[model samples]
Target: MGSRTILSSGTKTEQVFGYSRAVRAGDFIFVSGTTAMGPDGPVGEADIVAQSAECLRRIEEALAHFGAGLNTVVRTRVFVTDIDQWRRVGEAHSARFAEILPTTTIVGISALFDPRLLVEIEADAVLTTG
Candidate 1:
């Protein structure tokens, strides 16, 4: 087995919650449920599209830490408070992953950790070597 690397987004909540924002084990990287929630408050507020975009941006940042990117991503799971807004969320997601075309699933949930947050995204990626 390859060595595991724990990656952080430098969020106080991560330490308090005792979880890494992302972790790499062997060639695979797993990104936890990422939100637009900031230290002060939510980034995109009640806008699903904005929140979705913000989530992808953070996920990309996390993937970059592992020398990977959206291209390396194989799958994604998106949780949203409103299933009706899936189209808006998909538009935001596709904007980042159009050519990469990673397998994705969007599920509607009752609520996130915060009521202001409209969306949360998780990703899995595998590093490609030459």
Candidate 2:
């Protein structure tokens, strides 16, 4: 089986703890947990909704790097620092994958790597090829 790594410009392997943001093995693309951090830095200080959107955007970009897109996502996992923000976060997520409607799970966590980080997301997708 052939394998490949995907990384956006300025995105480091160490950022994801020594792992590539996304790895492609055959037709499957496995994306690691993606935070709101952008190429310059994190987005949205304490806005869970904005942060959630940013996280999904980054994940989508990672998937695209591997010839995949949000529509190809098969499953997803989301983590939020506060349970009360579920509605806001969920709304943001839904807007991103509304068409794909991939299987998803959301969990409330005590905290994340950074206090300002309100959400994190991970996904699995399949690239379509003829």
Candidate 3:
């Protein structure tokens, strides 16, 4: 089957590292690990909660480009630099996916590509065939 690339003017995607921000194969949209980095710059320099929200927000935007939304997400993976912020991160995540509640996994990580990054999230979604 053929695949499609999803991109938006609101964001800058990275592919030089041998990966895409998101790829659409048929009706499935696979999103790569999204950090809190925005078009302007990274968010929540020291706040994990805000960072987590930003990551999810970026993922939502990527999904939306492909006619998909957070509600269409079937799976999500979260990586955090600190485990102590799990509660706060979970709250932020729940607020975003409260209605859909996609299967999710959270892990405590030592660090990320950027030391300022407190959280990263990746998602998999199924777009409506309409």
TM-score leader: 1
Which has the higher TM-score value, candidate number 1 or candidate number 3?
1
Arranged by lDDT with the best first, the candidates are: 1, 3, 2
Alpha carbon lDDT of each predicted model: 0.91, 0.82, 0.83
Better model by TM-score: candidate 1 vs candidate 2? 1
| Candidate 1: stretches off by over 4 Å | none
Q: How many residue-pair clashes does candidate 2 contain?
A: 0
TM-scores of all candidate predictions against the true structure: 0.93, 0.86, 0.86
Cα-based lDDT at residue 53, candidate 1: 92
The clash count for each model shown is 0, 0, 0
TM-score, cand. 1 vs. native: 0.93
Q: Which ranking of candidates, highest TM-score first?
A: 1, 3, 2
Question: In model 3, where is the ten-residue run with the lowest total lDDT?
Answer: 7-16
Candidate achieving the largest lDDT: 1
How high is the lDDT of residue 43 in model 2? 94
